[model samples]
Target: MNSLSAFHRPLGSTGLQVSPLGLGTVKLGRNQGVKYPNGFELPDDRQASALLDLARDLGINLLDTAPAYGISEQRLGPLLRGQRQHWVICTKVGEEFENGHSAFDFSARHTRFSVERSLQRLETDYLDLVLVHSNGDDQTVLDDQVYPTLAQLKREGLIRAYGFSGKTVEGGIRALEQGDCAMVTYNLNEQAERPVLDFALSHNKGILIKKALASGHLCLHGEDPVAKGLELVFAHPAVGSAIIGTINPHHLEQNVATAIEVLGR
Candidate 1:
């Protein structure tokens, strides 16, 4: 896209080659109580479209969204139309945000309903990937019939791959063992979850690095903490991609450049 060095790789054994960086859409929808050091107004349609175009131009093909991400799904439904072919959309199930609180429903019926709603909202017949948005009780959710429901959806062709965006090392590993991918945090401030990536590498399951920059907190001191964080995550052979949400096009471009540098074509 932007004449950047190539840095695409396979997402586990899913047969889909994806960019090493994914654009997270939480910022595109929600701005309340965000963890960023600075706050900004939500982008309107024109700005959102331009941002997506810029991401594509920068060789970022992955987009991460969730129902809990405020109006993200509804907003992207139209914004992503006609450009769906170029993105690997990864939306979530099991968590819904309303009136400033999160609620979980991972039952088979609700899971099916959520998938249907996501498909409708995203204006797509199918999703490239889906992750269980754990409410910190990762194992309990899986045990309470979330994973099985998603597995059924995979068989039904609603999602190409399914995994867990887990909060614990054990839960992440368990998700990988049973599912196609595991989204975990692996930044400079946190290395306790590195075992999850190791397990994914050994088991050939996909590993998506969440909070690779600690949700923007990592940039507080260093001149290039984003680059430093990406270097740390991409150094691991297990990492499939790092999902970073930023409305700033310059930051996205800089991130892509940093990723290519760390990955080294």
Candidate 2:
């Protein structure tokens, strides 16, 4: 199969192009309080760099990270030095990870602070995209305070686009109504947020899929569950990219190949 770069598509109305799959970097920062099917040690710098090289060679350009993912942003900052233009970096605000726990703050002040911190952590003057990390209270998270703050940041050119990584279908719809994109969970095991995807498709907004492989829990005693799961996700034309968090090089290659095969690129 060819590289995914050949199939890059517009990320809604954001004026940015992205790959069909994004690399989720939660494993690069924290190995604690996760739901992965297998335990893994955090890769060292050399190993992490090698994985990134493999991802770029595979034509994956989108990178998903968040402050709630421990030090993922911190690590990516140095790792991505001098190659910022090649990536469509998507990070989050409103949630923080510390002491093996997660905390949420959607206030305007914290929102600005979080964005600035991410800029510094990512070692970039501008972020390609910034998403609000929802604490499950989607309505409250889409409140006037934090959402507007992100909009202001976009206007100020600190971020190219802004949206919410929401938990509810209603919140996902509302987020797209006021922002550039919305991240939702849609997979074989869960379709509760399918309405959100439909809205994005109808409205020409961006949709990023989380837990596309059910966070690595969809492995069944059958033939190629990964391919089956990816087939279901790619069935939605609104899906801008599905974030896969696998750190294994072989799995990454397989996923890229599967995406290429599914899309027939």
Per-residue lDDT tens digits of candidate 1, residues 122-237? Answer: 99999999999999888898897788989999999989999999899989988988999999989999999999999999989898989999988875464689878888898899
- Among these predictions, the greatest TM-score belongs to 2
User: Which pairs clash (backbone N, Cα, C closer than 3 Å) in model 1?
Assistant: none
**For each candidate, what is the lDDT?**
0.89, 0.93
- The TM-score measured for candidate 1 stands at 0.96
lDDT of candidate 2 over 8-64, digit per residue (tens): 999898998999999999999999999987889999999899999999999999999
Work out how many backbone clashes candidate 2 has.
0
Query: Highest lDDT: which candidate?
Result: 2
Residue 104 CA error for candidate 2 (Å)? 0.4
Cα lDDT of model 2 overall? Answer: 0.93
Q: What TM value does model 2 have?
A: 0.98
User: TM-scores across all candidates?
Assistant: 0.96, 0.98
Which regions of candidate 2 are displaced past 4 Å? none
